[model samples]
Target chain A: MCNTCGCNITPGNREFAYKPVNGKTAVSVLENLLARNDDQAEHNRQHFDKHRLLTVNLMSSPGAGKTALLEATIDALRDKYRIGVIEGDLETENDAVRIRARGVPAYQITTGSACHLDAHMVHDALHKFPLEGLDILFIENVGNLVCPASFDLGQHKNVTLLSVTEGDDKPAKYPVMFRAADIVLLTKSDLLPVLDDFDPERAELSLRNLGSRAPVIRLSARKSLNLGDWLDWLIGELVQKRGKLASDVLVQPVAEPQSISSNTGMQG
Target chain B: MHEFSVCQALIAQVEQIAISHGALKVQSVKLRIGPLSGMELPLLEHAYPFASAGTLAEGSILEIERAPLKVKCEACGLDSKVKPNLLTCRMCGSCKTRVVSGEELMLMSVELITT
Candidate 1:
């Protein structure tokens, strides 16, 4: 019988309570959860490597001009880089249609009310696309600045876009997303001169205050101002990352650091 | 927003624990939610009932304990609790502090009643 809870448990219950147990079991289970995602991410990474693909995850709020930037990016880089896109949304295939109009292969993943896209979803999407002969792959995460920051979509880089219309305090307000980002893109730069709230210097200061040293690129997709620099930077980064991966694969063994680090260490 | 999805995951965790313990009913669930976890408490609580329905934790009460965000100061070399939105060091006014803890979202304990 148990005396603490006053439960009618014979000697069997006592044995169950005090038996030698492995404490590491709980830690192992917790590790397994993160490890499972990392395993899927590594598989996706290898897929990217085999094809020499550069994957970028784009995160931003709804109506923050993510699709507009994609349209402009596809228009600019499609001729130079063999670009592909995986668009995530709650219920629309609108963004995919836009990307496909630019003559690049695009896939739409409707999360069906899920806020974020996990690595498993990206892995499945990779099978749908012809991975051979692709230079760059863009993943437009569901229009969310918070939840998407927590998920790993097997991307080489994560970029957070904040528009001039959304004000400059976004980096300060949502530090997690900014902290996790490899690049901070200030979209709709043309509106900075018109809007009273749009202060580029203040925005940069706030972004710096959030401890993100990621290069903050200012460009207006609508006006095509300073977009050349943005496209050039992206193309250069994609080429550099692909080259590094190929060289690493040629040198390192199969068991090298498999997990993708969320921090890309790219500072502006 | 994502609180509903998190609630679903929490319910799934509780159900697995209940089944392993041979528990027919769940009494309570304790969770440690950090201040910097970006989870809204009221929204999570509102979504919990819908998520827990028809599961072992159908009538279980979810007790949440808030953990303060802890940051490691680069200048002072001290660990201090700071506000969620503020990224400044508590001991020294250095803005170069790194986060060490208080981003936890875990199921700490569960109470189950067996038949």
Candidate 2:
């Protein structure tokens, strides 16, 4: 049998053996598998721009207090910001139900057996939402770090959460997620005193090493401690994004970069 | 696990490639997963069969090539492979670095079997 593709073997068939004809002829076509996802993400970006809504994609591992933090955040910003949430999960509508109970528009996207929320799922959920009055949209990505980082949800900002119990080395262990995030939130800080190896300083250093200069905020959702800072930061970001969008339409035409050199500049 | 999602995407890509190649089925999928990509090989392998069932890659084997994390350090100005945890420059111990390569998750090629 061929090891590369698991082709079946035949007796006295040297052609299908180690030197199979056309076996080495396999061409090297380098393509990013996330290309399709990226295309959909671009569409989602245009859609968000059309509606002038600020979107935030929240990511974290399971038990990282994503839902709890959102609950607290919604309560803090509900009076000021017209917030909407799209919750992604594998099985349950539990997070959506909790968010909706808080009197905000929340939709649940059950991916069936899938582990991440792609741009298509969020695009589908957009129809169910009233985009006219909403100022901010929160997409609670499926509880995973790896696959979700490969996908972009057309959000104005991507926020990654890590609980104190999950260890401070998460940024070191998962650099992709940390590098892609616009902000990193450390949740469940109340448990820090009870836990032994919960080093906030070391975690901050690790986050810095991951090439993320995003402001890292520590808060305990359960105790609602230091949550004001998180809420303030989110509101500030939303305001800044909204202001930029409005100014982009009114003040300046789209600026195209002129190539001064042969090399194309990297896109942020 | 998130590997199941990646497997799902892989299956879709393989099916598309097989159809375009006018093949009956995909024989194998060649993937390049980077070291800093944070993908667990064992979980991805375990989820492959489950995700590929009823698709064009129903019986296709997934072959993965692991790429090391290549970085350029600001202090040392040397490009080298570094461990995932210790991203600092090996020579100067400086943490200022930029990733030049090895953060890719790509499907390089697909082997299709024709009748």
Candidate 3:
């Protein structure tokens, strides 16, 4: 039994407690529940920044061609830039295998029962995955539009894919997911001629209605159609990231004892 | 749902606060959930008991305060409350608006029993 709390809770089993309280005083703990995850995400971002890796998180519904887009992207930019992938799925190594077959280094994070891939999982994946000599690292998030948006996977940019078959009203229904996207991709455009029910205009309109001004690009990874625009976007982001990195290097200060002292104070 | 996962995080936070404050147990936890927080209140409520089962917050009550979805219009510069699905500016009806609030999922306070 614990004397202070009047509970039989060990530190190990303290996480599981069932008891009513007799109070004397109350303390206000104003905190963000997502602080832990956010902190981990910031740490991951620092890692990416150190390696100068332009990280992109791909979010979308299942079968929205997140894997297919990665394949196409790797094929198009492999010669110009070294690419890596961190694939997140609920089960199986299917997506990672596909990316590996393209001759690029890939890591698979099989989140057994978790609906979304949190930053802790990504941090763990970074241990097994090599970050050296890679210009771009794409994190293909679990194929869920809702939960994935709530998580920050330490990505520099968020690319959300909305296939034409998923209906035009999806943005209206899944506003949070769409709103978080830095860029929205309208995938499976090859079927657009056959499907008159799904309006690309309506989809963009709905996304706009959600106050998301992210530019939308229509492309079909399978058909290899209009993939250049997507490639250009990737290159543009990479160039901008490299430019920032170069400036950061130029602005790097000399080792100072005072700076170290200030950093020690910040540790608290 | 992810609510269970979120509730677990919330419970863990509450427990930490209780221990740090040298509290015997937690009486209640207050939360400020915004419209754009991506959490369903009913689902979160359902998952709370299971998440808080064996912790200091086991029998604690959850007092949730709902926040309105707010948007700032760039064109009109009006800060107004708007609906989740439709994020258009309420004043100038401009689509060029920015979300100023309603994406929060914060643990406002924890009422602890220190006796």
Candidate 4:
């Protein structure tokens, strides 16, 4: 505790804990919790624009197969376009390692106890990223369907994974996430044939009820079913976004960086 | 889980304000939260004490102002509060409407005390 004031002055994580409160006077102020995050997000947008980068923020619940989808995506597109990933999780660099194994530049942001990835995390990831001429960047957010919906990570697109095993009513239960999604990917479709409780029609109804017009694409990354649509959507977006630059990155001049370079430890 | 993080940010904001105004403590924080804001008030309140632990804002009250979803009808020009699942204008029964409010997750004001 501070000797001057009865406030905490810890020397560690909460070091900035205590400061002397000003002399006896009442002060009025107004601010928003999201203001700082939004500011950083705007800055990230400018940076992506400068590099002509198309960034995607992927959010989903645990076991939603986000990593798997990303792996398959990288495999299909790595030969065509320069891809990079920023994997977010509460703990573990394993996700980043997985993406890097696919020969794509991957960075990881461990959020500690935080449930979502904010713009500040993405901004920091970009600072040390060694790859250049990246046509597409994907920030795979921490696997939490509820929290990640609230924070914007300054991505060009927000793709949410909804595993079929989780049930069809998720959109109704979590309207905010569904409403914010630019694309709702229904993963684990291979198991849908066995899961009797899940209904794709009901999911569509729920999305409609929530006033979401975003397209829902069902696919099983394991079986590689209907992945063509996902790739096609991505290709169309990249082609539209890069304009002339699309031709350059599409050529795949370099082979896949299979050996995960030491400097790209992805943990910074 | 998200609420804890959010409350931490709120407390930080409050602490910054207290420091800037030379206040001894924070009394209350008034907020406007809409349905679309994606924050659960009860969770936020529950996380407040944890966020304010050992801080000047400890025991501070949170005054929440409800910002219901409101939309202005483009076809009929009538603006009013709306239901969460329904987007049609209540007056003319038209679907041609745009959101005007209820998306706020704003800190309206803060009450602070010195000494």
Candidate 5:
């Protein structure tokens, strides 16, 4: 029987195509819906790799202290590494301006109605903001826990911030975001003394329940409490990336220049 | 909602496939979505028609298959299907389990018209 219309024809019957009512054919096209986005992410990754930039994507809800963390991190690492920031917001350049005030190169992407920062948007931002000579590029994604976790913006690491004000159940509530995180930052730790409802151990437990082994660090960017752990994590990632690149340069000395040039010169 | 954007992407991919295969219109689209895929199925279903309007997949049926969250236990060396909230191994009940399969949002196949 016809699936669409009540006719005496079954599916995969090519003979029925000649009939008036059964003209449809089923094509087995197995494809990924996120292929377009993932392709763009890979392209962005190549660009970052060519410049030897360690890119980290920060995701959180609004007022999660992502900007404040970036400000403190920039201040701490400015003397050591060249840092740049890509701030994503709905309608303002407020976050970008804050980063720039600290004497760092910052580019803001106002997503308009979009809730998350996609790879395509990040790719466009890369064109406007040069990635050269930057040790670290922080992509402070839109303050959304749900959407940002789904889209890959070609970042080497995903850092999720859960403010103490938001309760410890956030990790359990937003398991997808927590699972995607390489490291979870329990931000605004200074208020822990006053707030008796939130527990750091419970938050880490919820994250671990999601089958994620990502380490959780408690820090107050404003108070600079236990901020060294966050800084150490960033430095460790940078050192690991440099080690990988150094080994690549040694193993494929001839292939390194060709690949890097092709990636860098492709757009030009 | 981001579901609308995700639906738009899905419709665009389906339309492109239909056009590539010289299809007259899309009859049905099959998808395999997992619990951990970070997409609300109801919202995606609600946004489908609007996103697919005036496109090849306008009147297409969306056949969504829900996949089980599967994990592989490192300690037990066994793979088992588990709940989304608790991703531990079912047989061994180990916390050191790795996600083998679950977080997938794949377009499995499409049914289209030729004439």
Candidate 6:
């Protein structure tokens, strides 16, 4: 059947063509749509390495208290770690301003209509940050649960925040997001006790069902409940990053000079 | 939905592949989207034309294959292909199943017309 004009094509009057390729075979491309984005993410990873930065990408739905959690986290850890933030929102410098008020350098990327922030956006945003002195870089992705899971923002860790009011079935309903997280932050735990339907065990089961081994830390950024545990987790990650950096420095000072010269020569 | 952005990415990818292969037009783009891929298939199809506008893949047919949810039962240690809504293990009725293919969004292949 003809695809258009609602008429049968005569011998040579065909508009659509599906030829036999004339002996030149077609190439088979089994590629992912996000391949280019992931490549850029890898480039961003190397950039993070160049600056000895430990990057964490946080994802959640809007009003999941991502910004509030960040504000609290920044206030608690600013004295210990050199924190920097790249805030992604649909539209507003509000989150970035909040972070800066806590004394951390912040750059905001307003995605406009885009539901998520891709690695290319993060790569571009890196130019605004003086990453040399930054120890931990947090890229708070646009308020979205689904879209952000597929796009890696060159972060070393993925923390997905789910507030109790959002319900226990989130991990079951939106498994991809929770499955991608290294740690699931159960925000708004202060309200959980009052809510009759929100069950913590039920939520944990959903996480387990998705094969997520991410430790769930329940805290309320609004009330500062269990914020200590959250702070400890951050401190532990920072210590690991610092330890690795120290080990790298130690090895660099004692490594053979011939390989170093060859590497330097390649750049020259 | 987020399908517009996904289609936008898909268009960018298809255009690059077509240009690199020196192909003049794309005949078909085959995608394997899993049930747990977090993308709506119909919305993606609707967004395709807009995303591919002014590109080589503007009129190309998007062939989407919905990959079934495959899970490995933690208890039974066996793989089971199940429906999207029901993720429990068929053999053991266990909810402790690890998803294997429910999060796929792969461009399996592209048929291009080279001049």
Q: What stretches of model 6 exceed 4 Å from their correct place?
A: A1-25, A242-268, B83-90, B93-97
Each prediction's RMSD over C-alphas, in Å, is 7.6, 8.6, 6.6, 9.4, 5.9, 7.8
Q: Which DockQ value does candidate 4 get?
A: 0.37
Query: Candidate 6, B38: how far from true, in Å?
Result: 2.3
DockQ of each: 0.34, 0.36, 0.46, 0.37, 0.49, 0.37
Q: Which of the predicted structures, 2 or 6, would earn the higher DockQ when compared with the native?
A: 6
Cα lDDT for residue A250, model 6? 54
Clashing pairs in 2: none
**Measured by TM-score, how close is model 6 to the native structure?**
0.85
Residue-pair clashes, model 6: 0
Q: What interface RMSD do all candidates show, one decimal each?
A: 8.6, 5.9, 5.0, 6.3, 6.8, 9.0
Give candidate 1's fnat, 2 decimals.
0.11
Query: For residues A93-159, could you state the per-residue lDDT of candidate 1 as single tens digits?
Result: 8889988988988999998988888788888887787866778889999988888876667788988
- lDDT per residue for candidate 3 within B1-115, as digits (tens), equals 6888889988887887688667788888899999888999999999999999989999999999997899999999999888898999988778999888898898887788777
Over B62-91, each residue of candidate 1 has an lDDT whose tens digit, in order, gives: 888787788887778888777665666777
Task: Give lDDT: candidate 1, residue A217.
Answer: 88
**Which is the better candidate, 3 or 4, if ranked by DockQ?**
3
- Candidate 5 residue pairs in clash (backbone atoms < 3 Å): none
- Cand. 2 TM to true fold: 0.78
Could you say which candidate leads in TM-score? 5
- Candidate 5, A1-268: lDDT as tens digits: 4222223334666454433347776755456677779889999997888888899999999999999999999989899999999999999999999999999999999999999999999999999999877899999999998999999999999999999999798877888898999999999999999989999999888888887889899999999999999999999998898778766666765756766455333342
What tens digits encode model 5's per-residue C-alpha lDDT throughout B8-115? 989988887677556788999999988889999999999999999999999889999987889999989999888877887789777798887788898887888878
Kindly list the per-residue Cα lDDT of model 2 for residues A113-232, writing each as its tens digit.
887899889888987876767778889999987778878778879999989998888888888788888888888999999987989888889988765568899999889999988888
lDDT of 6 at B103: 72
**Candidate 5 local distance difference test against the native:** 0.87
List model 3 lDDT by residue over A1-268, tens digit each. Answer: 4322325555666444433345444444456678778889999998898787899999999999999999999998889899999999989998899999999999999999889999999999999999988989999999998999888878999999999999999999999899999999999999999999999999999999999889999999999999999998888998898788766665667476464333222232
lDDT tens per residue, model 6, A1-268: 5312113434465324224365222445566667778889999987886676779999999999998998988888778778899999989999999999988999999998888999999989988777867878999998888889888778888999999999888988887788789889889999987987988888887887666668898999989999998888877886787677556655785467664443222232
